[model samples]
Target: MSVDAKARYAQSHEYARLEGDLVIVGISDHAQDELGDIVFIELKEVGKKLERGQVFGTIESVKAASDLYMPLSGSIEAVNDDLQADPALVNREPYGNGWLIKVKPNNAKDMEALLEAKAYASMVGEE
Candidate 1:
């Protein structure tokens, strides 16, 4: 699997990709693969502030349901409504169209602290 080198990941499997001043967030491909086919997603409202490592949502898959964590402290600017209609997009395109949220990150340093593609892949045993 090709992980997005531009994106950073949390130990918990959430990924954050910087785009201008906002950060795009989502579950990593590894997480979705582990959970199997995603069936439902419950997300925090837009404009809600969330701390790093906070449970911002829940993802239910064929295998099991999992908590979705915030990779950085910030206010959610947008949620992917597309997922409500086609949740499997998360499994199909986790690094692209399947992204879950857009956040205005609170700290640049926090963004830097996340795992790089190589590190994250190694952590997940994909390396």
Candidate 2:
């Protein structure tokens, strides 16, 4: 598996990647690993508004069903529908095809508040 890229991370384990006003959101490799065998994912719909740190979805695993939090405040632009059919993509390519949503940021400066990959790695005790 590829290491989590140098994207921004929320303490809740959500990751964020910015592309213009679009901020892509997903759970980190570490979070997925900890969750184990994802069976179902419930994502916020496109056009949904969300606040940073707010619970927007849920991921169910063999072990548990956990809340998915927003890494940045935004209006959901798109959601990965592929997950409704096969949640395993989150394990296969979390940073790419498995991303959860594209959000149009409501506060651009909020991106700066997320933890960097290195810092998140530290927070999760990777180093």
Candidate 3:
């Protein structure tokens, strides 16, 4: 299980990383590993606005389906269409090409309220 040192984490296992003006969102490496092989992903449409902690989408794997939560309040700027065709990218490159969404946060400062990498790692017992 890998924790992104540059990303902030929610207790629910989602991660938020700032990249320029957009915040990139995705399930953590530990999450993908726990979920087993991913088969499908359903994400909200671009431009949808959601509050922090809102259900943004769902990810289905061979083991089970899990609801994805918003780590920050934001408008959906982009969804990773690549996952529709190759969901295992999540298992292979969770923090890279497998990232789930790009959000335009309502308040970038909200990221400060999330867990740091070391804290998140400890929460998941990866520390």
Candidate 4:
């Protein structure tokens, strides 16, 4: 998994990127690599309000199913409809076309506390 300079990460492996007034959230590339061959993902509703560290969804792989956590508090603005039909896009592009959700952030300061690429890489032992 490559580092995204503009993104921040949670210890649980979720990534968040601030884009305008919205924050894009997704599982990190390292996470997909660990999960191996993701088969399904269940995301929360678009309008649902989520708190920091809340479980908003789940990702199922051939090996195991894991909960997806919200990196910060927000109301979901959109979910990646594309993953409903082709989940492999996550494996191919976890940070791009495979992004899981977008949220209207409730607290911008929460983002500042997240791990930076270098810190996240070290947390996952990439460094």
Best by lDDT: 3
Score every model by TM-score. 0.97, 0.94, 0.98, 0.97
Ranking of all predicted structures according to TM-score, beginning with the best and ending with the worst: 3, 4, 1, 2
Report lDDT per candidate.
0.93, 0.87, 0.96, 0.93
Residue pairs in candidate 1 whose N, alpha carbon or C atoms collide under 3 angstroms: none
lDDT of 2 by residue, 1-127 (tens): 2346657999998899888768889988889898889999998788899888788899999999999999988899999999999999998788888899899999888989999888888888886
- For candidate 1, write residues 1-127 as lDDT tens digits: 6688999999999999999999999988888888999999989999999999899899999888899999999999999999999999999999999999999988877998899999999998887
Q: Which candidate has the highest TM-score of all?
A: 3
- Per residue, candidate 3 scores C-alpha lDDT tens digits across 1-127 of 7899999999999999999999999999999999999999999999999999999999999989999999999999999999999999999999999999999999999999999999999999988
lDDT of 4 at 1: 70
Better of 1 and 2 by lDDT: 1
Clashes of each: 0, 0, 0, 0
| Deviation from native of the Cα of residue 103 in model 4, angstroms | 0.9
**Off by more than 4 A, model 3:** none
- The segments of candidate 2 whose C-alpha lies over 4 angstroms from its true place after superposition are 1-3
Q: What lDDT score goes with residue 26 in model 3?
A: 94
Clashing pairs in 4: none
Superposed Cα deviation of residue 123, candidate 4 (Å)? 1.1
Better of 2 and 3 by TM-score: 3
